[model samples]
Structures are given as structure tokens and as C-alpha cells.
Target chain A: MKLSREEVVHIAALARMSMSEAEIEKAREQLAVILENFEILKEVDTTNVPPTAQSINLQSVMREDIPGESLPAEKVLANAPDREGDLFKLRPVLE
Target chain B: MTDKYTDLTIHSAHELLKAKKLSSVELTRYYLDRIGKIDQAVRAVVTVTGDLALRQAEKADKLIAGGKDGPLTGVPVLIKDNMCIDGIRTTCSSKMLENFIPPYNATVVEKLNNAGAVIVGKANMDEFAMGSSTENSAFFTTHNPWDLSRVPGGSSGGSAAGVAACEAVYALGSDTGGSIRQPAGFCSVTGLKPTYGRVSRYGLVAFASSLDQIGPLTKDVLDSALVMNVISGQDPKDSTSVPETVPDFTKGLNGDLKGMKIGIPKEYFVEGMQPEVDAAVKEAIRKLEELGAKVEWGVSLPHTRHALAVYYIIAPSEASANLARYDGSKYGFSYQDTNNMWEGMEKTKQLGFGPEVKRRIMLGTYALSSGYYDAYYLKAQKVRTLIRREFNQAFEKYDALVTPTSPTIPFKIGEKADNPLQMYLSDICTLPVNIAGIPAISIPAGFAKNLPIGMQVIGKPFAEETIFKISYAYQQVTDWHKKTPKL
Candidate 1:
């Protein structure tokens, strides 16, 4: 399982991260070693096994859909890096 | 006070508080003084909430005076930075949120507060709980209290070291793979990872949601049980939290494990495991046998080899989804780029998160992406199921499974920093329990070359009572849990 540089770039882009060429190369090698080690699972017979999403065998524990006190708008925006009157401002998404 | 304070467990501390021998303020101050002196070299604490802790201690003293003292009344505890504490800086040891203060408390934090426990401070962790060693923490690396140069097994290294140093009576830590247990092993503390969903994840900064669980790092099994009792209950805020009644976990502490069936998995004893660790674990098992527990060798978790791989894929996949909310918009660092919002997001994440965190996010994004979902993410899920079924079969014949909590002892800080694969292997033995969502505990087994080794005792789902019984019984017979680092 060889992870190509291009694949690394694609992964980084999807993850919202930027990587240098050197880091991409290093990631390619490391990811390949991990992927190769994982190949051992190929020999195990999982035909009858059901995928376990969570460790506890539990069903949904839903809460009543009720209204709750909302944080003040100023409090919500207090931590934002950039904001505009209850709206978070960002660099323009589309040209 | 030094003699009384040196080895005081939460149980004893509460007893003293009730008898007026020790005030909550005095206890909190004692710990703060200890942290001030010892934490300089170890760097275990990232933020010390001295004022808030003292305020809570005063409140607890008032409660004790009013005859409302609880089991953990006036006990001071450290929380891993990843768990949100309202109005306190919850950094997760990353530069990204270095200045961020959570507006609300995490469920576990709220529970501890309600139980009369004082929040002493926030402990350091790998940035966003992403690394095996605290070196990855952007703030500072926490050194093992046993050997200042060696790494405290992480990303719960701070919690483990805090308990080891007696800086806090007990601390709360989250374990995704080996975060709590490995650090506990290294620091010679008792740490447990309750069955997944046992502790609510309402205010936890999600690492790998499915694999992550909040548990206690304590000076001994009894204190672990004390903290677990307060925190292990369902919360309406977290959808994944189980609604089952949390039993009085301390109730079975004195229950004899005389005829209990203990399983020793052959797979965990595989080659490459440190010989000293192997000997320590075996000695602990022999002691359990001497204490009247029956030991049986059994096959377990044939797919155990795939745990690390599957964990890397699944954990990061969930992490990617969870961390997506940390865009420049909501909280944390944001890049100023007039070009475009997506470009700004890319720049913010790239600049904010450390290399290992970014690497995982990338791996997870790739695995969960449109074209690769079936080949990687879904396939890993199937393997995870197989792993759980294997444990179910083993538990049918055995009451508990025993293994070395960590395959090897703690490594030097920089030894495995560059090798991501080497770092991932640290979690190998501990990952299976999380994958199966079963209760598991790491107790101080014995020392290997002066460093601590931990023995893991894993029990069935919602069987924390069994874990407590086994651990408490073992602690009674052996003094491993009593030894402290001569820092």
C-alpha cells in the first residue's frame, strides 16, 4: 500500500491543512508503514462479524426536545477570532 | 501534617475532614504548595486554578460544617486540559486554543463540582490528546516523575504525574487508546477506562469520540472508585451516555475474588514486549493467584493485531469530523486572508495544530473521503466488530482478562518523536478494551528497573464493580500501589 505524494496532498486538502513537500514525503512513508502493518487484517475471516460502532451495547438515550437558555449573543461571539454583529466574519468564500 | 498528608487517600482525607483534623482549605493549600515546589521540573500542570480551587474548598468546608459532607468532600482534583471547565482556560495543550476559555463545564467537571470536589488545576496533555508522549504538547512536555528525563506516558501524562507527585489527590483523564493507562503505568498510579458511555462526553473536546472515555487517575484503587462513583452516570446532554444506573462502585471493594476466573491472553505475551514488564505482570498474576483467584490461560482477540491500524483510521475519522467545528470562525486561531474563507481555514488549521494532529486529520479525512470510505473506514469498522465479538466469547468463559497495560515502559522524550508508527505502537495493548467498550483498569503492578509497570484487568460491559473488586483485593495483598517516586 504505497501512499503517493499526490494522495498525501489530497488528504491534507480534505483535512483543511497545508503541508510542505518534505512533510508530505514523510507522511507518505509513515502512512505506508502503518498501512502495510494493517494488512494483517486481510487474513482474518470477518464474514460473520458485525461491525461494532461503539463498545457499549446501547441504543439511543434521547433527551426530551425542550427549549433551554441560550448563551447571550455577546457571550457566544466573545471567543470568535473575527465577528460582525452576532455573525462570524470570514474571508470571502467565493471569488 | 506531612506524615498525614504523604500517603493520604481520598477515603482517609474525607475521614480527616469529617473529624476536623484537616480543613478543605488546608488540604487544597497543601496540594497547591506541593505543586508549586515539585511541578517546576515535571511540568505536569498547564494551568493552576488556585483561586477557584480555594473558593471551592471554602464552599466544601461550609458544607462539611453543615453536615452535608460527601465521600469526596473537600478533595482537590486535577482535570486534563481537554475537558472543559467553565470560565477556565481549556487549552488541550495546543497553541490553537491557548487562550480559549470554555463557557460551560464538561459533564464530568460539573459532576465533580457537585460532589464537593475542588478543581485544583488543568493538567497538560498531548495537543488535543493526539500524541503518545507529552512532547507533542505545544505548551510543554511533562516529564515522568520517576525519572525527570524520561517521558510520562501520555496524553494523560499530566494527570498521571500529578497523582504520582501528590500534587493533586486524584485527577480526571480521558483515554482514547492508552492515554490514561500508559501514563498511569509510567507514573505508578491507578487509572481506569470505564466501559465506553459510562462517563458522559458532553464537555469533552472530542478526540476520537467512540474510543474516548473519561476516567480517574488516582493514588490507589479506592480513590479511583471514589472519583468513578461521582462521575460515572448518564447525562442528558450527551446522547451517547448510557442511561443505566451507576451502582455504588465502592460497594464491592471488599468482595472476595476467591473463586473468580481470571483469563491471561496468550496474544499479549507476544515477542518484543519488554522482559521486565513481562516479569512484573507475571508476578502480579502470581500474587492474584496467591490471593485465591483462579487463573486460566485463554485465547483472545485474534484480530488484536489490527487494533492499532483500525484505531488510527476510526479515531482520526471521528476526530476529523469533531475537530471540523474548530474552524477560525467559532474559536481558536484564525488566519487573516482576504483571498477566501476556505483558504483562511486551511491557513488557520495548518498554523494552529501541531504536525501529528494535522497528520491524523489528514489520514482520517482520506479514510472517510468519498472514494476511500469503503476500502478504509468501513473495512476498519468491520474489523472493529470482529474484535468486540472476540472479547465477548472470551468473557463468557472468564470473569476478567489480564494483560500488561503497556507493552513497554516509558521511553525517552525524543526517542520516538519522529517516528509516528513507533508512537502508535505504545497504545497496542490498551486499544482493544476501548474498541470493545469494556471496563478496564491499570494498577501499579511492580517496578521494573526502578520505573513502574502497570497490570491491566479488563472486565465485561458495565462491570466496573468487578474491576473495583479485583483491583481492591489485589492492592490489599500487594504494596505496589503504595510505592511513590522519591522526587
Candidate 2:
């Protein structure tokens, strides 16, 4: 399907990406070509075929819930772009 | 010794170390000097861990002195930047993770450390391994060592270029869809993409989890096997990892392919492929027959034409979900301080991700979005099953399938950068293997004009030994793997 400017804006919003009008225009054109290329898959007949999400044949593996090793809170928060005294600093989530 | 150490493979270098003729520090220094002098032109290395590598080399020397040795001990290797290294900056060649140093090592990094492999540096890649050329890297592009004017295929371009330039003995590269093999092909080196669950993905910044697998790009097929022996295994950290027993992959490098039923897929020899690439691969198949392997044509993979389409949809869909974690809240780059959280995230993503990455994320988000998921994403997944089934049935009649790793030799740097569809086509030959979660290797087949052509030997799932055996045999009679680019 050919993507419109409005659809591109909605996708960027869902992807948390902000784009300029020029970037959106470029994206709309490129994405339209890519999606059109995807039209080839529509030719295949997969009447009863189940969608394959995982490649290997395996069930959800359950491991022991006991904690073996955990990163310290300071270490866990080490790479945070913004941090408070002991918590991640974020823009106001609650008014 | 210093001059010779730079081109030595892991096995040959290990032999020297074990024979007490060389020290790991000397080998490390040799490679470091080469990288320092030549990597400027190649632009393959993102960050050179000189001090850490020297430190590791010193420790490896001590281990060798104590008579404790392994194949990779003291062998200098490059790590693709996406794999997290403790205290070392693990940028995915993007401004987003430019300074993001992980406090922990990836499981593969830990495994390499245990094997005593000297981690020389991190190699550049396409940002988030999204594009087919390193031009997508937010930092800089890695030029092909064969000819500086051409591109080293990516997103593992840096790894392949580094090895091709003799900057390191071998390097680890991830293959989501031909990332490792395509670059290896373009750079004229040996690269293997193991089965999906053959190697652990813990700490490999996920691109497409179902298709992503880490493998080696080496100077030769033996080095590929030597490195694979160290990296391939099940890890409790990666739940999708198969519980199959890990074998010594190097054990199959006996230069034997007698009675091996190798199939030459007719679908892979499609039109528009460079005639030389087609001829080189066909000649390589004849050479395999000379070694007593039955090379048959007419092995049909009807779904080959649609593998590329299925891959773009499925890979980006997974990438969209995986990359959502890159919000400004937790780590990496952030923007618009003192503003609302939503604005900060939007601005950060807009600024942090490169154009190709943003393109993929947008593509993925649209495919997975409501009202389109079933038509695009779900339909793609169903075609994915047909692609996988074709491989399964083909493998029933053949031990491995041989094809040209790429449709053409390496092109000019900016040749396909503007056309995203053309760039995606760079991976046409190698995508089906990843889609089917099977093992495949790209070995230097022969030269087309001045550049190298890579021939792929693809095997069944978890059958790396089969491909390795065939690749080793092919490399034995052929000297293409011995030819190095004069940088």
C-alpha cells in the first residue's frame, strides 16, 4: 500500500520519532516502494500455513526463579541519561 | 616476526605461541601497529582498545608460559561494536550509543575472554545493522580493502574489512540477514552464519531475534572453524538456544567432501546476476565435483524469489519492537531536557537514529500497526514458512546447497546508498539461509576482474560441520582464500 503523509506522521508518532516535512516526504516515497516490493508475498498461497515467529522448535523454557546474580542498583542505573539520587529522572509523567 | 604476525591465522598463530617462538604481546602489537597505520584508510575500526588488548595479551603470555594454551589464546580479534563489552564503549556505530558503555560483557565476549582471545577493538557496522552498506553508520563508512573506491558489504563491513586488511586475525559479526556472509563475500574472506540458536544472543543488541546469529569472519575456512569451535554452544542466558551438543567444528576440516551430495539451486542463478559471479560459482561447483562431491543442478527452491520480501517485513517488524527500548528514559542519548517525557523521547529518537534505521523503524511500525498486521506482517510470516519448507525439502536430497554469496562484486561506495530496495538486494543470496535458520558459509571463490567473488555453501539447521567440511575441501584445492588485498 502507498503510504500517505498522514500515515507517515502516525507511524513516526508510534515509533517515537519526530520527522520534518522533508524527512516525512522522503520516508513516504521510500516506504511506499518497500511496501510495494512486499506485494510479491501476496502472490504466495499460504492457506493453512501458520505464521512462524520463532525458527527453532522449542517451547517457552522455564528457569529457576531464584535470583543468582543481579546488578547493583547503582550499576543498573549507570547508563541512564538522566538520573535522580536513587531513581531514574524522567520528565513529569503525572501532572 | 612482526611483519609476519599480522597475516597469521588463529591456528598458525596458536602453533607459534605453543612452540614458544612468539608471545601474545608481540602478536597483539603487530596487529595494533597495522590497524594504527592502515585502519585510517579502511575506517573499519570504531574504537581501538589498545591498552585493554595489551593487558589481555600480557595475561595470555603468562598463561602460555604456564603451559596452558588454547587455539585462540593470544590471537587478536575484533568485536563488532553492537556486542556489549564491559567498560568498553559498545556503540552500534550510532550517536545514540556513542558513549554508552555497558557494565557487563556479552556472553560471546565472556566466551572470547575465556578462550584468551585478545580483543583488539570494536569494528564499525551499519547503524543497528539495518542497511546493507556501512554507509548507514552514523560515524563513518568502511571502505573495501580490495579497492578503496568500492564498499565493503555490511552491516558487518567493518569486521570483514578489518580481517581482509589483516588488522586482526578474525572478527565476530552478526548475521540477521546476510550481514556476515555478504560482507565476507565482498571483502574476500571466510564467514559463517551458524544456525539461529547455535550461538547465544545475550547482549547482542537485538535486530531481528528470530533471524540474528553471531558467527566469524576469518582469513580462511580453517580459521572460521577454529573460531566457531569457541563460539558455538547453548547458553542458559539465551532461552531460544538449542540444547544440542556442541561439536569441535575444526575436527571436520580434513579436506574431505567425498560423496557429499551438494546441490546447485537453479533459482539462485537468476537473471541480472553479474555473469562473472555466476560463472565463478559454477566453476567452484565443478571443482567440488573434482573432489568427488556429487554436484547436481535442478534442486529447486521455488520460494527463493520471495525470501527477500519476507525478510524485510519480518526483520523490521521485530526491529520495531526491539528498538522501542531506545527511548530517552533509561539509557543512551536523550534530548530536550526539562521538557515533557514524550517530547524528549521523540526528539531523542529523531536525532539518535540514522536515516536507514529510522526508515526501518517506520517500515516496521507500519507493518505491525493495526489493520495492516495481518495483511503485511502475518502474510510475510506465512511466506517465511514456505521459504523454510523449501530449504528443508531441498536438504533432504542434498547435504548442502552452493550458490554465489552475492549477486555481484562490491560496488562503489555511494552506488546503492540512495536506493533502499537495491541495497536490500545486496543480501538476496544469503537471506534465505537466515530465514530458514540454517548454517551457511561464504568463502573466497575467485577473482572477478580485480575484486573477489564469494561462493556460499549452505547446510541444514545445526549442520555447520557439513558446510565447514565442504568449505574446507573447496578451499584446499583453491588458492582464492590465500590471496590477500594489498592495502
Q: Which candidate is the best by TM-score?
A: 2
Taking the tens digit of each residue's C-alpha lDDT, what string does model 1 give over B9-68?
899899999999989999999999888988998889999999999999999999999999
DockQ of each: 0.71, 0.86
- How much lDDT does each candidate structure score? 0.88, 0.91
Q: What residue runs in model 2 are displaced by over 4 Å at the alpha carbon?
A: none
Q: A1-95 in candidate 2: lDDT tens per residue?
A: 45788999999999888999999999989999988888888889999999888889989898888868777778768888878887998888878
Stretches of candidate 1 off by over 4 Å are B1-4
Least accurate 10 contiguous residues by lDDT in model 2 chain A: A67-76
The alpha-carbon interface RMSD of model 2 comes to 0.9
Give the clash count for each candidate.
0, 0
